[model samples]
Target chain A: EAAVTQSPRNKVTVTGGNVTLSCRQTNSHNYMYWYRQDTGHGLRLIHYSYGAGNLQIGDVPDGYKATRTTQEDFFLLLELASPSQTSLYFCASSDAGLANTGQLYFGEGSKLTVL
Target chain B: GDQVEQSPSALSLHEGTGSALRCNFTTTMRAVQWFRKNSRGSLINLFYLASGTKENGRLKSAFDSKERYSTLHIRDAQLEDSGTYFCAAATGGYKVVFGSGTRLLVSP
Candidate 1:
């Protein structure tokens, strides 16, 4: 099974605070994604990376930014956090390229609270 | 606009009963995936299908890209089967969209 580990399983911050969430996948998958799960919205993609130094915008990328520093590392940053940005974030990795696609393996999730 | 619409938002079944969850897509999708959120809050991949059907144990899933839909059938529901199920569809570019999810409760 593929392993994707996330740091700071839980976090709390005040408005305008800076927050960074970290994710590392050991499987060397070429694709990594960040998604947020809210009550009525379900899971919406925030950002994705095809490889190191490559980032793609997702549907809900308003208050967040992401970077892929290495093939195994992906990070999400919130520069001026607001209460509405508080959500459950998940990191997933896959080796999807063309016809050869794989299932997404997700991290345990990080719950953030902005007051 | 939401690309994937999954129903019934909630489900209840007896231990030996069965049911099916369906997802309707507004446009053609390249592939579909089903996942169950386990008690530990991990999203467990149940099935991934570009087309046709795949069965594992008492659970089976089918995807019809041309028809713009997918179905997940669960037979002989067990207590452990109770969880929130989500269906996601991808239309290439590695962008996957998820449905609202169905919460299933199996009781004895």
Candidate 2:
């Protein structure tokens, strides 16, 4: 089965603190994505990478930065955390194609609390 | 502008009953995916449809590219089936836009 794992399943941080959430996938997929889920709203994309060393901004990328150090690892970084940034983060991976023939395999998600 | 809209916002079903969840897309979508989020905050992929309908176990989903919509039908509703269901549409791009989600509650 395709596996995507995220570290620090839960975290609590105070305002202005720096936070980093890590994600690793064993599926060797070419595409990886980071999303934040909030109540009453759909999952909003934060960042995505097509391959190692290639990072792309998504819809809601204002307060977030991402790094794709290796094919298996994608990390989301929050330089200065704020209470509004608290959310459940999910990591997903997909095959080569854009979505025509590929399906996204998601991780268990990391719950972050910014106080 | 929202690309996807799912309805109804919330639903309640009795055991042994069944219903359908629909998603409407504002633009042309290349494909659609359905997911069910468990109470533990894990999202389980229920269906991925490029076009037409696909069924597994007691769940069925259909995607109509021409109409820009998708639907998920649940049969023999059970307590375990209660959760938030979301439909995401791929707009021929790298990103997939998701709906607001449907919160379902099934009681005995």
Candidate 3:
């Protein structure tokens, strides 16, 4: 099984504040993703990276920025945060190939509150 | 519009009973993955199906790409099984969509 860890299990910030959520995976997977879960919305992808120095926009990439410093590290940055950005954020890693059938290993999630 | 729709948004079951959760995709998905969110809010991977069925302990999952649907069956429910179950589908090589999730409450 792959191991994924997230920092700052909980966070609180005021509107227009800056926040960053970090994730590290030990599996050396090439694909990393950032998603936010909210009531009635399930999980919405914010950003993803195929490898270091590579990035891709996802379903809900607005108000978010991400960087894949290395294969094991991915960061999601929320600049000028708003109340709508308050939710549970999760980071995941996958090793899917051309078929894209691989399962994702997820972190424990980080809860952020915007005041 | 590509979407994953899950049924029975919430469910309650008694210990020793069983139930099934279903996810239907609006478009052709390459694969489907099932996850369970534990009490502490950690999402645990349950199963990943590309075409057929797979079982682990009291949990079983099946994916029928032709029908654009997948099913997760839980047998002999236990208190530890109470949480939210989410199904996500992989499509267009890189796009993954998640369902609204089904919250299960197992009571003694």
Any residue pairs clashing in model 1, and if so which?
none
* Per-residue C-alpha lDDT of model 2 across residues B19-86, encoded as one tens digit per residue: 99999999888888999999989989999888999999999999998998999999999999999999
lDDT of 3: 0.91
Give lDDT tens digits, candidate 3, residues B1-108: 689999889999999999999999998888888999998889999988888999999999999998999999999999999999999887757678899999999999
Candidate 3: stretches off by over 4 Å: A97-99
Q: Weakest 10 consecutive residues, lDDT, candidate 1 chain B?
A: B88-97
Q: Which parts of model 1 are misplaced by more than 4 Å? A: A97-100
- Docking quality (DockQ) for each candidate: 0.53, 0.66, 0.62
In candidate 3, which residue pairs get closer than 3 Å at backbone N, Cα or C atoms, i.e. clash? none
TM-score rank, highest first? 2, 3, 1
Worst 10-residue lDDT window for candidate 1 chain A reads A96-105
Tens digit of per-residue lDDT, candidate 3, span A24-76: 99998999999999877679989999999999999899999999999999999
Docking level of model 2: medium
Q: TM-score per candidate, in order?
A: 0.94, 0.97, 0.96
Report the candidate with higher DockQ, 2 versus 3.
2
Better candidate by TM-score, 1 or 2:
2
- Tens-digit lDDT string for candidate 2 (A1-115): 6899998899999999999999999988999999999988888999999999999999999999999999999999999999999999999999843356779888999999999
Highest-scoring model, DockQ: 2
